[model samples]
Target: MMKIEGTLYPWRFRLVLALLALMVAAIAIRIVDLHVFDHDFLQGQGDARSVRHISIHAHRGLITDRNGEPLAVSTPVTTLWGNPKELQGARAQWAALAKALNQDPKVLTERLEQQAGREFTYLARGLTPEEGQAVLDLKIPGVYGLEEFRRFYPAGEVTAHVIGFTDIDDRGREGVELAFDEWLAGVPGRRQVLKDRRGRLIKDVQVVQNAKAGKALALSIDLRLQYLAHRELRNAITEFGAKAGSLVLLDVKTGEILAMVNQPTYNPNNKRNLEPAAMRNRALIDVFEPGSTMKPLSMSAALETGRWKPEDRVEVAPGTLRIGRYTIRDVSRTEGGVLDLTGILIKSSNVGMSKVAFDIGGESIYSMMQRLGIGQDTGLGFPGERVGNLPNHREWHKAETATLSYGYGLSTTAVQLAHAYATLANDGRSVPLVMTRQDNVPEGAQVISEKVAKTIQGMLQQVVEAPGGVFRAKVPGYHVAGKSGTARKTSVGSKGYKEKSYRSLFAGFGPSSNPRIAMAVVIDEPTNGAYYGGLVSAPVFGKVMAGALRLMNVAPDNLPPPEETKAAVAGESSKPGKGDRT
Candidate 1:
């Protein structure tokens, strides 16, 4: 019986040993297949969980004035983002995360819940490097930080209208920014990185694509002139208690925009409560009836027809002319009766201008305005620029034509008016207005002959020199030539004009004999007692031009008399210069 039991135990041991060998062999084969045959597939799945391809933001271009003064720039910043799924059940760090982000715990929780299905969501944007580092140091799972850029304007509201602003995503929205977005925006690249379970970047694997920086943009603006214009325009707005204003200064020879500014401007850096009105580049986008400012153009047209002369008389007797039901009169009822073309301009008579425009005929006047860049774009490459309305010759009734001549029926922008004045300064050669610096200024279209332009310019000079001219536009030792306009504001959503609400405007240039700069200033809704262009807008032009001429070292064109010079040197009282009105 013992021998039989021993034999059975040996058989059982052999069967168990065979089973153990088979199990070992099967386990070894499985390990080999996973490590060698399916290695790529398993590694891919692991990488899919731990690795990511992230955007490597390209640095936006630098915007600078002609003198290399920085305007719009891109500064380094960090953006914190996270994957809600990775952050799921990360309740322990939620409070700390909320604290670091300056967010309420409940809000953070709700946001996470809302974004639960999203792979990426921004927790904070445009954070300082130190702040982002502190958040990353919290070691919260699913939290991450990416290096990015934020647009910054060093000049702030001073250059708001010209330089414009970008969105949080670093995209241009208006002004030069929107006009040259493609040129100013850079192309982004990509990078592969290893991230931990908490979504923290563990290692930078490789650059998927090299990022290229946007090309730097150099504008034609002179920072010195821009600052001067801004200060003067702001002062004018404040002094006049105006609702808003716009000013533009151009280089006569180059047709380059030397300075442009808008009032009620917003700071691009902090635009959480920005208004649409404040963001508009008024000089280029907003159009207003140029009022008496358009008188010079009318005079130019009449002169071009060979039917009118500087000495030609227009009997504005009673200082008013009836065109149908509308009566055109001078501000002073009897101030401009029986005046020549020169006198008409000097006195800024609506009656005289209406008659003159009527005599010239609407077709001729429209053609002249078109040639001078009125009712047309200045080609400054500005966004949302409106081509001013010019009624077709066939469409003009006698009254409509008269009103258009005096700048009531038609409209023009500050830039367009400036460009037209610049054309006069350029001896009637209509040049293209440009915002960016150009290597060579193109040949301008000949609108009026040099003789006509010179004659008109001289006549305009009398507008500042004559007794009834714009005396407030005077600049010491400079023969300034300009026109002032005080037009009733057209009521919005209605056809009639607003009573007592005026749009004051001034368009002119300095050194009347040898013009170097052409400028236009417009003040909207001056609530102060003085609302005339000569009283409100011309002073801004004077102040800005005085500084601009001195800064540019423009030679004094109108030297004072010996007595006056001596008196000025001695700080003594002296009589005004010739053509100066008391």
Candidate 2:
């Protein structure tokens, strides 16, 4: 057997053992220091790389009509974001991520390049839950999504002018949304969380601040009435081939706007194609000469001076009058021989109106206008609401005064006209117009004597009830009172007025005796050869009024139904011809 013998040195063996012991002691010391003395510091350094603070979104308030119908609401959404620096490192995943985001890869690369130093960038904001989840499923590095709220408008263009819409972050942008943004948008919250290297949330670390939900707002608008107004106004604008139109319906007793709608409105839900013109609330913002509708107010001013009575007479034989170089002419060339106050309204005699207003003087006219809330804040607090233009009485020339009597040299919004007519309908009491439902009736300021208001109301009723009246505005089973106006659009750059362009308007209320609602309809630049308010605007008023009265269950004031009038017409034919009578 071969035996192996080792010639080993005792000193070398002892040196190896000594080195092993030193290494073991050093390792033991390091373990104790790391576990006991520097544990918190080291742990904090590790967490700093993976832990992040995040925002918790809070939803905006809801906007509903008086009957609790939602006009505007918010829906849960997500915002996809990413660290551009980290995302740039994952070039191989860029094409897939771009496809997921529905963006071009080149565009994504350029965007990241543009934000080279940015640690964070938005890939997409206000994405739906499904869209965001589709992106998250890819699990690309540095890509992440956070909860958010996106505004949604259900009423679209129908209530766009009233309810408005919000921004990407759910901030109110227009209409009632902007008007009451603070009341609608609430505060956001914060949270701390642990995130994996791929930007996925692993666990919630701490809640920094709890979010407070926004309060809901209830408007005075009746969605049903609003829808009706929208449909009718849109139909009118299209039918007349008009540039734009507005309609306002008010509760005369309450001074609350039941419905306000404008044509040429845009869909608030999709704002990418928004135009500045479509965004305008024309009912509150646009103004024009009110034409013959002003005659009632002028007549009221004349009566206030005790210079005129409901039975008063004025000669309008010529149908044309000269106030300086301006030749004031009536719509009809045929002379209205003589007209009492009621006759003047029924005939819509511009000659008679000029005579009455000039006789009343400018101060009385201005006072009546001020009292009627013309050229004044509507108390709606709406953004971009114009007070319109009413020249100070002190600035009135003879020509201007004559023009003012017939609704020229002055401008007013549709809402202003509606409010003024509402005052007359409510027995000469003027109250602040409201857009929100009110629990208590607002105090009313008297603008005219109830006797005078009643008299004017009778005259207006005559305009619809008399043979040569605004028959187009008459409503069946209801005593309707209204005024029609056709004003030429003033030329933009210079000179007199546009030849054929006209603003057709109608303003009134019903049932005339116990007025429940007052409304105004204005159609701009009607081009379908029906430019007169009696022809273009009055029909809309009648249709809307008839439908609204029925919807509100208002008692019918007329003895016979309008449909019964067809039988009356048939009976007339059966009675006799001129030859048979002879």
Candidate 3:
């Protein structure tokens, strides 16, 4: 049998034949897999070598004011990205890219070196169309520009604080941008394309997802009102030589913020040189001891508690009252002995209000303030809103209660004070202060009886109409009621008030017959010979309110006679708080 097999085939030949058959079978199997069974896998492997990934950016949403005016928007832009691993003449390429990107070559070289093995590195963000094209013309390998968007603030500094700004990645960084980031940011998209050896796209492999642009947002602000407020605020700041200033106009019925302005505001378009003080939205963020502006709250508390009436009398001995070891005195040193509740408000007597607060007791007074929305957020949705410092009743010292009565011990933001006044103007029902419109009017929680509110309103009106009171804020044809607040700024190391620095505030609501607008204006450290709220801040309030009322188309209740309307002489005392005198 061995002899017969040897004769039939040579050993080497048999071995070669066996190896050839095995090789042929392996080839057939591989062909089948590549052609049919596992074609998708093999195709993916081929694409892996030749395909390039590119990102498609989705457009960011638009920001419009209440009247559909564009405050901020997204405009087409380009971003340059590169594959450092594929870059040739790394130094020259980097230098060219840096020149185009307006960046330092040395910094770019370092970035490229760090990302040597990386497939992608951002060379520059938010390039203009011309700049993007210049880079594209360089024809550098591994470098490409993608279409994107950059935020544009059309109203510039006027709408800066309200609209805010975005980061490089089109994400909100501050203000409304930060508050509504999710709604403002849109979904991104991606594409895979086959590229030739030269990195030119040859074919599309797949489209993973389609990009969706962000939805548009409408705000409650009016651009015209915003501009008016800004211009007036700047002029006031400059004229008074004040340290800073803020003004806010509110819709009395709905509580929608019509205009909010803070001086030392920054241009959102050029934020590189912005100062911290300029960026602060003082309306909602800064808190101060409200001084006599808070007396109305104290008096209302006293009246609501049935311990006192608008006609109740208090003895203002020496124009001062001593509580615990502390003594409270009126701003005016001319002493008066007996005063009614209305007289206390009209005179803005700290001595009288302290007695009233004592009559109301600490708990009821604090509870009333809490219900009036003081020491709380106004639900305005603004960033960094401070629920201004209000000490617990249990923690209150006798001095704290007495001083707080006349707005000394506690601190509050301008917005909170405005909201409190708005509550009073709204007939003792507290509506949620809003920045956006709602379909259904929010039901207000009753803070005081309508009777108490009416009495307080009448007394406050007297504060404006009375000759001795500080409210020379009356416009010729309209009824106005408000209080002037003057508080010596608290110093860090000083035991008492700062020598020359004081916070002056004027807060009021208009057209007493039918209140429509509620506003607050504050001037910090006015240096041009006047420091009282009535002297420095109220006139600005009058001008702004006059403009706002005209814009609102409210019929004038009391137009001045032609003689009264004549421009006052340069040095005449036109009115107590008129700008001419200030």
Candidate 4:
């Protein structure tokens, strides 16, 4: 029985060895099949878990003032992101991660739960590198930090409306930022990287696309003048308790905007709770009736028609003129309302202007306003600029034309008004307004005859330098020319005008003998009981223009008799005489 059992065991052992050998051979064949025939498919599956293409945010452009002072710039930051799929199994560490992120664990967990099927989600954005590093220090699975850029404004709210602000993605949203967004926004890039099972970056595989930084932008703004204007305008706004305001200053020779500021501004750096009203660039985007401020220019139109002379007298008797049902009054009546053209301007007499408008007809006034860039595109390249209204009547009547005389029928913007005054400053030559610094100023068009423009400019000086004029706009030691306006604001939906609400305004240029700078100021709804342009807006213009003239070292044409003699003596003494030229 023992011999038989041993023989059976040997047979059984042979059969088991054959079965084991066959199994090893089948496994080897399958291994070769996977290694060669199905290699690409299997490799792709492995790569899907560990490889990623991440977006590389672009570095936005730098914005600077004409003097190379930094205004808008980009600073390096880090963004923390997570893979919801990878984070599914990372719940145990979510509390530690939430603590590092300064977020509630429950909130973080719930967010992850909601996006459990997603591959990526932002944990935090625009954090400092150090702050993001702290969150990464926890070594939590599925969490990562990425480099990014955040837009920063050095001037902050002081330069808010002009420079505008960028969105979180470093994209421009308004003002020059939006106007030249394509020039300022750089192209984004992509990168291929390898990560571990826990979503930790193992290595940078390759650059899918290299990021190109945006170009630098140099604006026409003079930072010194900008600060000065901002300070004065802000003080006036706060003093008068005004709702909003704008101040625009331009180079008379170049049509370059030197300093433009608006009140009720916001810090571009801090973008929370932003008010839409505060962001409007009132100088260009907002329009008003312009009120009596248009009198000087409109009178220029009357002169251009050759129907009225600077000394021509209009019988504005009874201190008012009745045109149809509208009764235009000279609230500032003098000598029973009989005034020459110059007197009309100095007194800002609506009755006189209405008579002039009636006599000259609306055709000439509308044509002149259009040439002044009113009711037409300023071509300033500003975003959201509204072309103010000027109706083109098929038949011009005395009553209809009267509206243009007092700045009631048409509307204009601060920028447009400044441009018109600048045209006078430039001897009737009008150039397109520009935001960027210019090496070669564009050729100006002769919108009005130089003689007529000079005559109007001379008369306007009396509106500021003459006795009983708008004296608040006077800059001592400098001859100034300006016009003031206090217009009743048109109610919402164009439902007539509001009796209590007034828009104060002033448009002028300094060194009237040879004007170099032109400015326009507008104060909306001054509530401290002083709503007139002479009281509220002229002071800002005077202060800002004085500082600007000094900053630019413009020669004063209105120095005292003694100072002028002294300056002349100094100039003669400094001269090298005839031999110096050779």
Better-scoring candidate (lDDT), 2 or 3: 2
What ranking emerges by lDDT with the best candidate at the front?
Answer: 4, 2, 1, 3
Q: lDDT (CA) for every model shown?
A: 0.88, 0.88, 0.82, 0.89
- Local lDDT at 272 for model 4: 84
Q: Give per-residue CA lDDT, model 2, range 59-80, as digits (tens).
A: 9888899989998888999899
Q: What is the lDDT of candidate 2?
A: 0.88
12-87 per-residue lDDT for model 1 (tens digits):
8788889999999999998898799978878889999998888889988899999899999899998999989888
Per-residue lDDT tens digits of candidate 3, residues 278-373? 888888888888888888888888888887888888888788677666778876654457888888887788888887777667777787788888
**lDDT by residue for model 4 over 1-582, one digit each (tens)?**
356754768988788889999999999988888898978877988889998888888898899999999999999999999999988887899999888889998999899999998878999999999999999898877888889999889999888999988877778888888988999999989999998866668999999999988999999999999999999999999999999999999999999999999988888888788888888888888889999988887898899989889888988778877766877787786876589999988888888888888778888888888888888898877888998898889998887688777788888899999999999889999998999998897799999999999998899899998888889988988999999999999889878988789999999998899899999999999999899899899999899989999999998887779988899888888887834755
Error of 4 at 275 (Å): 2.1
TM-score, one value per model: 0.88, 0.87, 0.87, 0.88
**C-alpha RMSD values across all candidates:** 7.2, 9.0, 5.6, 8.5
Q: Is 2 or 4 the stronger prediction by lDDT?
A: 4
Query: What's the distance in Å from true for residue 575, model 2?
Result: 16
Candidate 2 clash pair list: none
Candidate 4 regions with alpha-carbon error over 4 angstroms:
1-51, 196-200, 563-582
Clashes of each: 2, 0, 1, 0
